[model samples]
Target chain A: MATIADVARLAGVSKSTVSRALSRPEMLLPETVATVQDAAEKLGYVANSAARFLAGGRTGVIALVVPTLDNSFFAPIIGGAQARADAEGRQVTVAVHSFAAGESLTTFGRLARQVDGFIIVAPGGSDDIVRAAATKPAVLVDREIEGMSSAVADTASAFTLVVEHFARTGRRRLVYVGGPGNSWQDAQRTAAVRAAAERVGVSLEVVGPFPPTFAAGAEAARQVRELRPDAVIPYATALGLGIQHVYLVAGETPPVVSSERAIVEALGLAGVPAIDVDGRVLGDVAARLLSQRIQDPSGDPNRVRLSVPVTWGA
Target chain B: MATIADVARLAGVSKSTVSRALSRPEMLLPETVATVQDAAEKLGYVANSAARFLAGGRTGVIALVVPTLDNSFFAPIIGGAQARADAEGRQVTVAVHSFAAGESLTTFGRLARQVDGFIIVAPGGSDDIVRAAATKPAVLVDREIEGMSSAVADTASAFTLVVEHFARTGRRRLVYVGGPGNSWQDAQRTAAVRAAAERVGVSLEVVGPFPPTFAAGAEAARQVRELRPDAVIPYATALGLGIQHVYLVAGETPPVVSSERAIVEALGLAGVPAIDVDGRVLGDVAARLLSQRIQDPSGDPNRVRLSVPVTWGA
Candidate 1:
């Protein structure tokens, strides 16, 4: 609860001197900075980020915007991002855009003035809107806009792994279940799976752009069964679990390849294979990159792509 | 983007009049309130809740505190609550308490100042801490504490239905797999099941205070099989799915009772019966109750309990 004025009075320095030492220490004298820091430490001055934002520009708070909090897809990412931010004395406020067009832009417009930066996860808005909204330091996770820093999973390699497994298992035809059409990850995944299937000389049938739920997956499963694909590739774990359930109910053994280990685990998919994308690691990396960008907003955007490996359960 | 000054000028009123019209309309003259409201709507004065908090006591934002966001148990609840809050033009900020001792109290301390009210879901804190934290307008969801408004699921009736199903099916011994020890719902469900089992003249074996994940369920399944319970009752869908998987892997046929429809649907527990607790409905009701509390902080606390019904899937 100690304020900057309290630290300044304790250090025998002006309020501006203490502010300069904290924000631009390199420009201040070392002795002055050291004295200010010592005084701040003695007073246990945890600078109120919101109050600082009123005088200075940055509030040590960052925002992580996701489509929705209902799925486990964003849970680890959110946990990782918040943990990393908290370690650095920053707080993360999560806002759900709910895959609505222009929702991200609207949320960003409201939050940008308060938070120092943003880490938008799989934004549903158009690239133009995203670019316009991110006036502050911003990092996009699992998607890439033209002018934003991003951390994306290696979808190409993930699909290649799944397709190779299908080929090895003599599954010539595969049905690909997808998520929302506006989803950047879903589009990338579908394109990658299509390219991979062509490379492996297997027929790939793309089913949907569903809401990424078990019910939607079950509904898609009926379509998949009618089409009779030799194997299945679901873009998300939720969809995969749904398809798996429909198959289980019909007492049919259908081969499936999922994109997340969490779904495989949740469905008790032993002997079933999935690509481990590690959303937490992606979230951590994105937070680190965003923090760096917030410190220096002039550089070219940094793009990080984490690799996804196939994991099999016993 | 229209400020209070703009609305006041347009309405031919003072800034304080505009503020009073929005915060406490009852204090203003009816004609003056209508004039201010019309001017505010014309200028599109969507008050920034954070800035409003600094000027006025209430911030149009509410907090939804959950133990963790990872499990599907709270997903629908969160979604429904947010949806309802959004319809009322209130923003809900979610904070994870992680179910650790003192975690809920710490979160309440941090969030209590900025939010107008709180909707705490399945609070893991002790009764004293929970009661102390309700100094502000608050609603406890899925848990009950003395001197606090609450919306709890009828776990006693839910367990009675499950036990009756077991007794009718000729399953004498039922193993109950539980969630975290700190979980309020877990304790209630376990105690209810124990009482119901005695009434039904059936033997009940208690297994866990696990993390309520598939791995925990699988690990508990080993212990469950060793005990050779006639049927399994997992407190959560994730644990139920895990137990179902272990049974499938061992090719063992055991009747299982689950507590969530979403889980049953996700895991395709068609033949397996489950109690449909409808978390979305619970969330909506809790949000409504909390909103009411925020409006009238001095009212006698409202307590609601929704019933859970057992459904046999085909």
Candidate 2:
């Protein structure tokens, strides 16, 4: 049977280099890894994954845990991570915490022993609990923890962009619908919008503690109409659509700025103008940072802060 | 730390019975299992999950692989499996196949050694690929495989209900907007709708092979209007909303039927009537079957066919 040695010989690299290329491609040059992979493929050399797992006591699997899957925000993150992991012949396992008490901790504990590392997205637990349970290589996405590597979106900038758009369009009486009270991004966006609204001298009323669902948006639309905001900024697509539905029914069309393109597209199909906070970049950046951390577990903490690019569409 | 012996003594059961209750509660009477659980809780016994994993050569983690997370259809299934697994002190890991070439097979290969069981939801690949890779205790959802356990929803009945609704309303010129061709449910739904429409003696025009996105729905809406059907049945909520959006824009409203409650609720908030096919039951049943098979891998294969319950709401 063809083996690593044959691939190393064929690729003109040492056997250890070939091993690193297979196991920790992030640590090696892309060209070198590609060459190794090509040679391995040409030789019909398939790595015995089970034998390797037995020898190293590692599962060749990494896990990404999020709070929920009902939202589209987490979909891209999973896609980016899975894409990157698949390129290196690794697999990523996703689990949801559902914000249930002791659930995240239990998941981390069980998977920490089985998988090589973990990437936790928007952990809704105390840092002490996460820190205690995460004994393996780990990275955080959309939230930051002291002494841990993380990748976060520039949410404050996203809100600033939306508020600036409202100002540019001469919109006054702006109402901000908040997301879940426990969400870090929701808190950041609320604070940013309040500051920006004050700077722009527009009347801003922030209302919610909404759970970021379509139903929540439907319920919040009544309050939005009462406030009589000319412009509405909702933290989720479902909420944005709900508010838009309200205006459409009332025969009064108002601008609704959303944080996702999907919401904009859905409303735009009905000729409603909206702004989107580009979240697609979050997943790709988080995946890169996570892969780097996983390849070299003892490396210095690396923080990636991605700016939110705003797009106005009709 | 409390041990199994202490719990067994307190619960007045043998050690083997206590172990069976913990691992495979389906094998024991519900009352006896409840008694054992109560005793364990009273005694403050925390199972050493990691030690048990090492001793049994099992990871204490089950895996669920889906085609994509872009749609909300799979959310309930995930929640059901995760909730059940959590109750038994087990973790459910999720992975996406993305329907790429050999993707499901590769995922199954990588995760097979790391997890004790698997529940693959709506596999997009050939059945042979799935049957080949699934050597561990496994259950299928939304699709069936010969010689394997499966849980499938009754798509035929759902279409019959929608067709009957159309017939009852005396609506003619029915248009059916279809989902992706490769989607098993989409194919099943399309065939069922065609058969039912014929039985109802309605003229049916099926359009699509669309990607089931808002944009695709928007595009399909243009075609739908040209067809000028009195009622339209979209295979998915996105398409139905798209069709509805077109009508609302043209200032000519037509009745649209959707298969999800969320879509119905969103549009119903605008006073539109719609039908919902509950997918919430898929996950719970699949989870239960998977758990049973995992506990008794040598048991007879079980097939569960869930009837679709349709609800019409404003």
The interface root-mean-square deviation of each model, in the order shown, is 5.8, 5.3
Give the alpha carbon lDDT tens digit for every residue of B126-206 in model 1: 777666766579898999877788888886687778877888878898888887887888888888889889998999999
What global local distance difference test value does model 2 have? 0.71
- lDDT of candidate 1 vs native? 0.74
lDDT of 1 by residue, A49-106 (tens): 4444534546556778877777777887877897677556466767666545634243
In the range A62-136, model 2's lDDT, one tens digit per residue, is 777788767766777777777677656566667676444555243344446456777788636667766675678
Worst 10 residues of 1 chain B by lDDT: B102-111
**Tens-digit lDDT string for candidate 2 (B69-114):** 7766677777777766765767677767644555524335545656
Q: How many residue pairs of model 1 clash at the backbone?
A: 0
Model 1 C-alpha RMSD vs. true structure (Å) is 6.7
Runs of candidate 2 exceeding 4 Å displacement: A1-61, A85-91, A98-117, A123-137, A262-301, B1-61, B86-91, B100-108, B111-117, B128-138, B262-280, B291-301
For model 1, fnat equals 0.18
The CA lDDT of each predicted structure is 0.74, 0.71
